[model samples]
Target: MEVPDLRSLRAADTPVVGGKAAGLGELTAIGLPVPPGVVLPARFLNGNDERALADLLPGLVRERGVRPPFAVRSSALCEDGEHASFAGQFHSELEVDEAGLAGAVVRCARSADAKNVQHYADALGVAPGLSGQHSVSVIVQEQVAADLSGVLFTADPLTGDPDTYVLEVVPGPGSALVGGTTEPLALRLGSDGVVVTTRPDWCDESFEARVLGLCLRLRELGRSVTEHRGSPQDIEFCTTADDTVVPVQARPITSLPALSARSFDLTFTPVCHATSDELGALARLDKVRLRLVAESCGLRVGRAWIIRAQASGSPRQEEPTALPPGLSDAPQISFVLQDPARLGGSIVRRFSAVGSRSHDLRETVQLVGASHDRFALIATEIHDAELSGVARRFGDHVVAEVGFGAFVPKGVVATSQYVCTTDGTIEHTEPVRQERAFLIEQGMPRAVTIGRTPTLTPEQCRMVCQAVEVANQYHTRPSVEFGVERDGSLFLIDFVEDGADDAGPRPEDLGIISSGRLAGRVVRVDDDRALELASLDSHFHTDRPGAAPAAVHDPVIVVAALPYLSLESFIRERDATSLGFVFRNCSYLSHLSIVLRELGVPALVDRQAYDRLRADDHVLLDTADRTVAQVPEAESTP
Candidate 1:
């Protein structure tokens, strides 16, 4: 009795029919081509017996003038909201016969509390069992045998740019688009032009225009449905065998700008907002730093530390806290003012010195990647004078703790800097602008060479751009290390604060060998036998009494003075050990660099810094910009 005719429903009936069914009904009411369907209200499952469900089936069949072969889909109440769309999270069964109809409906209804769905809800900040409105409705629709299907965005949700609309098309049902099994033909349309961002060979001119027209119309319909022309919307559509466009679903885009995979520049820094007058304020900063490092370890494989700091006043004898790995030299940590405005004069006076350093940090918190409607609005408010008041009101700090350091499989060690301005413009260094111009002028050459034999490909460049865009949406500069997997999909493995340090100045006499930003302490490998056995046993007995081998300590550099270290042996040794290496005779394009690229090991060959590096001397190799700094030997205080 609670089953409502889909055609008779409207947007206001969302609680009864669920978001999807109500959306379909709204489309039908608006004269959009939506397949005929019936909605079984979530409440109907509360008391109905199998016999009662079976009895109601006949009426639905009669109403649709069809027998069997129904599409049983989930229309959960929490789905397709203005802020979050639980797309593909719930179950949807197609080609369900009359015998299986009741069972399919039951499964769909039960999926509201499914583990993955609940996990997704948690990411959206929805606590389970907290809302009394938790329920799911089943949608039994007459399936449209579609020849083509796809999704469309009324605006560029990634960048929040309303000037453009995006469309994606596939040959069959839109499931593959969501499943990501196949790359769909993706196009972007603006007032002046329509550009094919990505396309398959099957895309004919006629089909392209048909999809374009449908996207344009659906975008207009989306705005009309929301009654807000300014807001962006996500819409899904399909075309039947007869080529009639059918609008399937529509919802408001509730994603953040920086989290999206759009190409925008961003700059990030590790500045915690707390009053200088608060008790244990400095302790809180250390706690935040430790939490960031610990979270990064749990989330991904990496090491993190505060490599630099800014100070104002001289020493007050305070108890020293234990510094994390890569930050043991806290007392002697360098500082330089990049932006005086970042910390006001009063706050600057609190520190003896202000400093910054190059680092690789990655963040994997839920807030950084989820709905930013709240965080985006409150981020600015948290940094104001009333920081404690705002923190109390929000019950949590505005800045979500993010992970940083060597978390990704591969690192695209870049010296290029990108700045995302408030006006939505991505200003970059002259080199970056030149590179972009080259990409545009040369039309994405099949390959790009950093040193030799093009380790960075054009396809990879695109992936990097995508990662940068997504990172920028977080409203921070994120240094990203990303790569394409064997499956042809791109993944962002590392995201960290972009402390924009000019690589200082390049040494003219320093020979540029292997290209990458790598730093470690030099440990001369005098014996080739020791090199081979390094993989077998990480430990070595030094001639000196009770001296620990540097190899066991991470980030120690293995200086191979010989020119003929076996490439295979070198790789095997590096694979088993955590230490980086230095080569005296290897070229940038040598077999060694290629192997390093495959192994994701950071190294340098034939650098002038090595000439002065004695055994156990710690050095920072800015290889990408051809600079190096010798780290002073300082003991940890605590």
Candidate 2:
């Protein structure tokens, strides 16, 4: 079939001849400054016609009238699919003289049969044997020396914002421009002029206006095509030093994801090196929930900010205004910590300072401190070491040291509360700091035991009791108990039905009992009974009621610091008098049971139960049943 004239081809011909060829034809028909070219019809390669293509190319070159150099390129019908939209799938031979154009056309035609191009087409669900039917269309145009060239999007490609359009222009040859190797000047067009240019080497005054005018015209063309075809488009254009603008190619934009219609009122105060995964997780959570968590932790949700090490050399010290909807309030901070050793200190200082001042704030500020790149490398090394034996024996909790001076543990934020040191060791001693010790001394109660298990050791019981004691100090609603054998074997066994302190033992510690049986024991105690005696020293302890005649029920579970009270307290204090719970430290569950018994109230000491109670605002009175009140009705009825 004879190839259609450039001036006679309409939008309907785009899919038949590919985006670049169709765009050239449209520009030529519209009287634009497009180079003279001819599209070799797709029907020419209807069969494996190398001889036919070889014969036709020579005649076409002779017919062009001028023996000048020409460009030969592929123009496959399926080159620009709706989704895949292959930008550089086919071959293009530039600077080919008319004598060599025929040979170049044959070579370009064979590139479609190349392994890489075939694989790409296959990946996009294109069938084989289709390439031979897709012939090369030689665009024998007089190549222009482009002083500036670049791409333009009729809409904001990154955000899919309809009201906004994006354009990029670069100074250099058009080859460098299409390759994306050269830095380009970016312009955002909307109600306001949003221009972001980066090339300090090239500066021209008329370049900006020229590019904007080209963009406006391109937008009109794109709108007309989109209106006809029903979709957005991506366009490529070029301008010579003499201000001659030419449309090179145009295709539908295919990279954008579908967005939901929802408005959010949120703010993010970011830390350094935050991963894209972390950002995605944050995006899944409600902004109001995040704000509440930040505030509860004494952080101001939207205010303070810091620059990332990578972005330090960037021209803008701060990011531009929020993009909109999806990421309008994302914190501009990255969460990668330069050094793991300094992370804990930095977090402590920042959190302490923030907690001291903010009263109305109820936002949760996430402190991301892991470098994702380094983390992956270290994780691989650890996995290669076959540390599963140590992990399994020690509860899959082994911390490995990496070459980059970072610790690689199974889960830092997800499983553990304390930060690991650079040497792949937990800074366990740091938790016994003066402030923590002081807090412990003020309000927690010791445990109670009747008969110690002969198989268990004292140190084991102490470790078990320590976990329970910590939970009691931090929460307000339930009773938690850590049991141990008489010989000092530790077991985290029981939790009261309506207890508080929802934060459970870290995932790494799930099976790591502090006993000599696993590696070396980290916990130490002289006697099993003595550890239970220590539980009596906690502030939550009170005497059992009805144990003695004429004893009044005055069960009192001591509250350590009011700051330690979690959201669970508001729910669990329903039946009990929440008005005058004294805040103190060092108490026991037996004492609390005694006090509550005397006061005709039930007391419990179990971390798991407390976690459940906190998570679900209800009480489990027995093994078979549970009691829950509708939250709204419970709050309002009372």
Candidate 3:
């Protein structure tokens, strides 16, 4: 057959135009937003067809005003089937003009015999047909410049939930994602709602909202395609600057895992009311007032119920104090705080365990107040609240509590330092995107990327505002620490007695994490976990193996929070290149600091410097000069 316009073709034309083209043809015929294109048959590529198409190729560049700058892609006969995908194994030339179409088509056709194609076919158990024998048609279609592009799986591959779909999106061309240099913003969407698996640094509420809408649309589109194609499909799509989602390709998922779910008891029991005496186990707070204020904003107030030896944590201690009958013995949630009051160098003890099964509860484990120091919020299963001693457990003071709570499992969480005014207006210290955190799964914490993180919704923020107002009533400019759930549920972790000194600008005139002298644009990795930034010199570390590997050569400051052993390569990679580094949050005594000193390139590890810079932002960061200034974008040009 001769070159077939996309709309003129159908599913029956797979032998000539191949699956990718036929699929696009079907989508176009069914009124989808696929860029218009025409396909040259596989016979031409495999040398069984005519060469005269080249003379006609430039004339067919525009299929009715759908002009070049076209994208020429491979659509082999053996590809896009239920058994094999051949994804990224073939060639795709983007942004080609009419004059370049003939050459691009030749390149894509020749790639059918590339070694990578053979290797992929062999791995997939396909018979040796990838040599000079594979049939790969060429598709020249309008290339849509995307604001965001990604891949969407119609079913949850991780949990095997057909009802759930996953979308991974990047800021610019989808090639960046394939390049392994950037992590895409991931979303889990179902009939219920959208859950942001990973939030990209640039992803704010508005960006998230737009993506959610696009995801729902894609879901509808996928359903339509699946109905026609007869299986759950993997779709590659792009959202243009105009917010139009164009489906470039779709194919049936070949090896979707079976449904498997992890069971962990991270649920909370009902609220148990208690008198001020029982609540007094927690330090220095009006528990009765806290309960009223916190519960009003839907925050569970955790209070410990002191026990003497073998006392079961049950009720009979006032209204709404009913205890759970079959509570597990494990501490489902643990927040170990060093009590901000113990400032000087001292022994320092646990803040308190509301649901801890530990026989040795701290002398005073209070859960309410400002905590600027480190704290552990663990979630597992709740058990008995048994304590060995009430007064004489070799203690400074006696305390108890009947409480169990879980924080929003670690991921990309937005933290804001703000002061709530008497009128309930909040002066934000700015929402600082934290580093990759230890997300607890099955009671075990593992360091993961942003995809495991949750975006704080507006409702959650409103509740925080309300909770802060309550704290404001008790203390001057009181701040509240809250654990936000994946579903945007809020829990009042604690009401801080100390937070944001009038919520003013952090004294930038002091405090630097590391010291070096250099200037460059900043590329924020958003993965704040230090152990992960070890190879800052040569590569932009992200999850997943990239389809294309690259090393850093541009003069840019790499920003990350965590630095691990693999980071030593940063020195070698940065040696003669335009690479600088910044520690978003780190300590001077850390290994990353040592690397910073040894790093011949310019480097700064100041939180302020990190906060001042953004992705691709021209900057001049110097420790010796103690300056973090923005350089003009034009100045960064060679």
lDDT of each: 0.47, 0.38, 0.53
lDDT of 2 by residue, 1-638 (tens): 26544444444566566656765664433234556666666555454366666666666655644345665667776665467666776778767775666566667656666777778767877666654434444445555566777777767777876556677787755666677676677777664655654534564666666676666555554444343333566766667776556666667788765433222122333422244454443322222233333334442233222212221221222322232221222222112122222222221111111112111011111121111111100000000110100011012122211110011111100011222232224432111111211111112221122121111123332343343333333333333333222333332222333332233223333221110110110111112222222222111221111111122222222222211212122123333432112111211222232233233332222234332333223222221121111233233221
Best model per TM-score: 3
Q: Compared with the true structure, what per-residue lDDT tens digits does model 1 show for residues 132-228?
A: 3458888887776778888878668777665578878888887787788878889887767778898688788887777766655545554444332
- Model 3 over residues 360-404: C-alpha lDDT tens digits? 232112111112223222222222211000000001111111011
The C-alpha RMSD in Å for every predicted model, in order, reads 28.5, 27.8, 21.6
Q: What TM-score, computed on C-alpha atoms, does each candidate reach? A: 0.39, 0.37, 0.40
Comparing 2 and 3 by lDDT, which wins? 3
Return the number of clashes found in candidate 1. 31
Q: Give residue 218's error in model 3 in angstroms.
A: 2.2
| Cα distance off (Å), candidate 2, residue 34 | 3.3
